[model samples]
Target: MLRGLIASGRLLANRATTQPARLSRNLVTAAGPTSRCSLPHTHHHHPVAAVPALARGMKVRSSVKTMCDGCAVVKRKGRVYVICSKNAKHKQRQG
Candidate 1:
């Protein structure tokens, strides 16, 4: 019984030491900032440039809509409309 316990304890100690080394090696190989922001490969690409704002000349006004407080007059669908700055749909599109 004593010999079996001693052997098992030694085996457990060996397993514990080996596990940490293996885990550390795996962690070292796997851990880092991944290429999350990489753009997909594509053909027929145009040079990237910042687009000037469509509503650059528009004036801001208090919102009359139910969704938000601040609003801006912008042309959409060949007609001008009041777009609320604090709208939930606008927040999601921005993100």
Candidate 2:
């Protein structure tokens, strides 16, 4: 019983009185991928010279027609697609 009490006392005496401040890890760097994007890469692990503005996607929607000048509504495989050849960001799909 005396040994147990001494060991508990020793453990309490060795502990730090104050906790250390936590580090702030929310720093954003310009060199990070979020700041700048590299060239479009293919699934084959090959980097392409450029990502075509009109990337084929099945999610093109009809409302995206006025988003770009090169937008065109295309029908493929019984589905509707809004394809923008000039700007790939405007691509949308209609259900």
Candidate 3:
């Protein structure tokens, strides 16, 4: 039941991002209507931080709120593990 809920939530999130995806597509099309251009040319600074930050916050909040399998494993280690783009995993594993 919990897994179903989680899966449903993921699906909803994926659906929600469709707008941004479409917007990006439109931006690409508009940038070069006649020719194929690279995506980096379309980059524009937004008022707020980029989408990656928002996604990170959502992931952190969800992980903190729910005691899911990965969180449980982290809890057993007596330390909190946060996912960051720079450092994927916080600590190095010892054999």
Candidate 4:
């Protein structure tokens, strides 16, 4: 039983070392800018009010079409506006 346990432990240690090298290589290639699999940079500018709503446990709605129960509303510069939902004056700004 002791021999079996020692063999298993050695096998596990060898396997762990080999796996990390393979994973690290893949990560380096994928993260490189020249790699075809690399994702495009996306700049998302969130409204100023999103910070307070996130702290208060409100989930950000994905679409403007969804009706919010007054939770996602924000007041900025004397104007009350819905952060996620589309208003009558302006189209919904896609993040």
C-alpha lDDT of candidate 4 relative to the true structure: 0.57
Better of 3 and 4 by TM-score: 4
Clashing pairs in 2: 59-92, 59-93, 60-92, 60-93, 61-92, 61-93
Per-residue alpha-carbon lDDT of model 4 for 1-95, expressed as tens digits?
99999999999999999999998788777778465555577888876765443322233335433354432555567544455433333323222
Q: Which stretches of candidate 3 lie over 4 Å from their true place?
A: 30-95
lDDT digits (tens) for residues 1-95 of candidate 2: 99999999877766543222111122233346366444467667556588567645555444445466798877788777777778867677776
Q: Which candidate's lDDT is highest?
A: 2
lDDT of 3 at 72: 26
Q: For residue 68, what is the lDDT in candidate 4?
A: 48
Give the whole-model CA lDDT for all candidates, comma-separated.
Answer: 0.57, 0.62, 0.53, 0.57
For model 3, what is the alpha-carbon lDDT of residue 79? Answer: 43
Indicate the worst ten consecutive residues by lDDT in candidate 1. Answer: 86-95
* lDDT of residue 32 for candidate 3: 69
lDDT of 1 by residue, 1-95 (tens): 99999999999999999999997666666664453334467778789899886643333334323345565555556554566666534321110
For candidate 3, what is the lDDT? 0.53
**Clashing pairs in model 3?**
none
Lowest-sum lDDT 10-residue window in model 4: 86-95
lDDT, residue 13, candidate 2: 64
